[model samples]
Target: MFEAIKLLVGVVSLIMVYRTITGNCNKYLAFAICAIWLRYFLSAFHTITYPSLVAGFSINALGSIGVAGLGLLLIPTAVFTLKKLFPFYVFFTAIAVSGFVNMQIPGTINVLVKWCYFLVLAGALFLSIRCQGQNETFKKLLVAFVMPVSLQMLSIVLGEAKATEADGSTSYIGGYNHEAAFSMIIVSFIFVLGLVNRNAISFRTTLFTVAVVLLVLVNYRTAILTILPIAAIFYFTLVEQRLKPSQKAPVLTIVTMVLAILFFVLSLSMQERFADVGLLVGNLDLIFKAPMYFSDAEQDIMSARVYIWSQYINAFTNADLLHQIFGFGPDSWKHKFDLYAHNTYVSYVYEYGYLGFISFIGLMAYILTASFNLSNKPLGKILAFSLIGFMIMNMATMPLWNIEGLIFFALALGTVFANPSAQKVSKEIGAGHKTSMEIN
Candidate 1:
């Protein structure tokens, strides 16, 4: 049954990609993104017949290389002269240079596969901007995100999602690897959808938000920390309008207070709800203990991640000048060190070195700068902030590598930085366009 579902989703995805390429109708990117996401959400139904996102299930596992149909179109259509795209090429150059400098050159297949995955993101991003020009496609993509996200939330109720014993502890992996992280990201995207559509107060949006809230509880994680940040964004945008400019400077203090109250109420409520289901992990006691994290060197030392991160940092710090500049190839450290840094930023620095890091960060800096500057408008702000939340999540986890998620990010980036839309966003932001836009 699961295999059939997976196969069906795969077929639909391919068809969408084909239409997107042949038709020169870029809006189909939305369909492809969701179709791929459906596969991720369906992983909640993992059984022996169809194991979780292992080989044979994902596109690559199904004996295909990285995305082919879209790649052909994107390769021809993508331009990198734009300041927003310069960083990716620089990062690519850094990665290529690393192979020659590092003693343990990254394996051919390993390097190629990694490059293909990133190329897919670049392709999707290029089209995403084009999608905005096709307003219907851009709107459709926004709407398409909601279905998979809501269904993914529904999966919590439908499936018996429990974590397996890996690393050491018995964690609650709602479905795929870091179900908690996945939930956090999905929920953020849900909010992005609402804001993008400017229909956050609607019943449809309410239903999805409730499901997301339920799913967040199911995961029993601090990944929902973004809620504090999000709630603050909402408050300042909606509430602080009546305040004087002097009061606006202290908005952070108000935001901090709001977060404190929210954390208390939310933690208590989540604890009680989860406890009723026999699913609560740590309750507020664990949360209140967060301060201990700052002082708890012993606990940090005991953490497997700390050990992994240390090993990675030491390798770069101790390497020769060339290795330090270029770093090991992506995942190359894991082959030699027996462990990989679980942190994405740390992992990137280890895999590509300072040069790669600078190029990548420089590129994102441009994108993010634009995102920040455009936060005055509705869709522009929504997509920009959504990207911000995604980046924050990547600080601790590597969900960005997930193609479904990566494609979504690229699409959003394009909407923010791509051609006519990018210019439009700047003008709109400068003019302080209305806070909400009707979904046309």
Candidate 2:
């Protein structure tokens, strides 16, 4: 019975997402529905009822694939890039070739599956860039999408939920984990939204303040640390300059900064009591104490990420040209040992080698640089900050592989890149560039 309900909810969510992208209903309404569905499905349905059979085809996985496919289909309709589809084609082609090579090498099928998912993620991002261009009202709709998620996160923090892993170990849902990524995305989204709508100073300030508080409660250190600083930079560089020289803007900025600093300090103070942070620290200490407790002290450091990263770095020190070019293949690292590098940069270099890693980095750099260059308008500034937040989160966490993160990134990107007018529009009603005709 629970399985059936879960499936039904998943299907409904997908339909709503479709309607939203196609602009059938108010995008904000559709986004609100989707956010509610996701929160309930993850928190209520997935947790309360364990339906193994139905769970085999989980909503999260299916949604990831579906969004990617849909994005591919819409590429041709985008007006921003003449051959807009080519970037996606090249990106996925690399994943496919590398994935196949990994499969042929001695390793588990898990590697292939992971890369395939990443390829789909690339597709989702491509579509988002397309969508961002065409969807002028995305800023308003995005606020609706983020509100419920923020409220749900607040509930978890206040409710004192236990943080445990499948192996009965303490685990903080840190960077790249589903919860952390979701929180980061929403907070970043809100910040950007606030900046874009800065003309309504009270509304924007209220929203930004709320977002910062929620960000602290989420207790994802990387998300909080990375986003807050970058957001401040973005605001000063882009949003602050637009405001008139008055007592209001400076006063508000000072208040915002003080509150942000206070929140950061309070969150750190509370970390000792938080279950996830305690567990994570405990585990790290245990993993580092192998020398005195056991004879096989060498393997003790395997579980320590710092140790593993050092090892990976050293492993590549004497690697040959061919190995550097083609890489060790997907999941090959796991086959050699039962550990992961836990860092994206190291993981990419180890799996795909130097050439592949450089190519991937270059692609990301191009996307980021291009996006930053285009962020001349109010909406564009929001998109730029959001992209920066996303990039920062990815550096520490692996949400680039997750469905939710991928889709959100895609939506933001598509909306920005697909619309030429997005670049030309001014934040001020009658400043800079204007025509007699306006959307009103």
Total backbone collisions for each predicted model: 0, 16
Residue by residue across 309-334, what tens digits does model 1's lDDT show? 55667667777886777787755865
Q: TM-score for every candidate vs. truth?
A: 0.67, 0.64
Cα lDDT listed for each candidate: 0.52, 0.49
Residue pairs in collision within model 1: none
State, as a TM-score between 0 and 1, how close model 2 is to the true structure.
0.64
Runs in model 2 lying further than 4 Å from the true structure? 1-59, 74-89, 104-136, 143-160, 164-178, 184-204, 233-242, 245-303, 315-320, 331-339, 375-382, 419-440
**Candidate 1, run of 10 with poorest lDDT:** 279-288
Cα deviation at 319, candidate 2, in Å, is: 4.9
RMSD per model, one decimal? 8.0, 7.6
Q: How many residue pairs of model 1 clash at the backbone?
A: 0
Q: Give the C-alpha lDDT of model 2.
A: 0.49
